[model samples]
Target: MVKIGVLALQGAVREHVRSVEASGAEAVVVKRKEQLDEIDGLILPGGESTTMRRLIDKYDFFDALKNFGTQGKPIFGTCAGLILLASDIVGQESAHLQLMDMKVERNAFGRQVDSFEAALEVKGIAEDFEAVFIRAPYVVEVGEDVEVLAVVNNNIVAAKQGQYLCSAFHPELTDDHRMTAYFVEMVEAAKKELAS
Candidate 1:
């Protein structure tokens, strides 16, 4: 069975673990950097981006997490996680992982009270994916290799670049496991390629 690790530093760790299990994979709550070696893929869940970064640095996971992605393992980021993977962040001097070649604007969906749900037409996934956005960020731009996955109200909410997948809304917040399943498939495929 494939083990999907959810970064337990912050955000919806339990929710993502449950979702990953629902998608037919063993889930691991990755609290330490060494845990990265035991998982096939990683999920960066939604939380306060700055606080998460601080925790990552304090735990000395900053380099380990980036190396994980660089090694061709799949990574799925949602909400604040998306902010971390972005190469450029609006009004910010530097980004966290800088793994994905995209520009993201944090909290582009307004404040916490503006949180809402929308049925998104996620490309190559679902015709109508129920996504929950809470203080979400939208992709302002993406590199040529990036594929836009879903959009809402003219804002880019989901995208995939190579082994990297990200969504502005929290798919784990809902009962839908298709998004998680898709990521699991990505991991499975990457693992096969690496072995070959």
Candidate 2:
């Protein structure tokens, strides 16, 4: 079975852990740099991007986390996590990870009070997936390699680029496990590549 790690630095760590487990993968909460070596894939949970970034720097796991990406393992980011993976944050001067070639606008959906749920037609999933948006950041632009997965209110919310996957909505907050299952499939594929 594939082992997946959710960055436990901040945010909905337990929820993501449950989601990964529901997807039939061994879920681990990643708190230290060494823990990244043990997981087949990683999930950056939805939380305050600035806070998460500060915690990452304090733990001195910034470079280690980025290096983990270089190993070609899948990394999925949700909400503020999406902001971390983005290469650009519109109107913001700094960014975390900068792994995905996309421009994201922070809190594009307004404040926490503006949070709402909607079913979206994701490209890979057969049916509409329930998406929960809370102070989410939407992709304003994508690079050549990036594939837009799902959109809502004319905003790019779900996107994938090679081993990287991002969503402006929190999937762990809902009962649907399709997104996590989709990610597990990506992890399985990457594991196959390594074995071959």
Give all candidate RMSDs, comma-separated.
Answer: 0.5, 0.8
List, residue by residue over 70-111, the lDDT tens digit for candidate 2: 789999999988999999998888778999999999999999
User: Lowest summed-lDDT stretch of 10 residues in model 1?
Assistant: 186-195
TM-scores for all candidates: the values are 0.99, 0.98
- Candidate 1: regions farther than 4 A off: none
Q: What is the C-alpha local distance difference test score of candidate 2?
A: 0.93
* Highest TM-score model number: 1
Q: Give all candidates' CA lDDT scores.
A: 0.97, 0.93
Per-prediction backbone clash count: 0, 0
lDDT of 2 at 67: 91
Q: How far off is residue 175 in model 2, in Å?
A: 0.8
Error of 2 at 130 (Å): 1.0
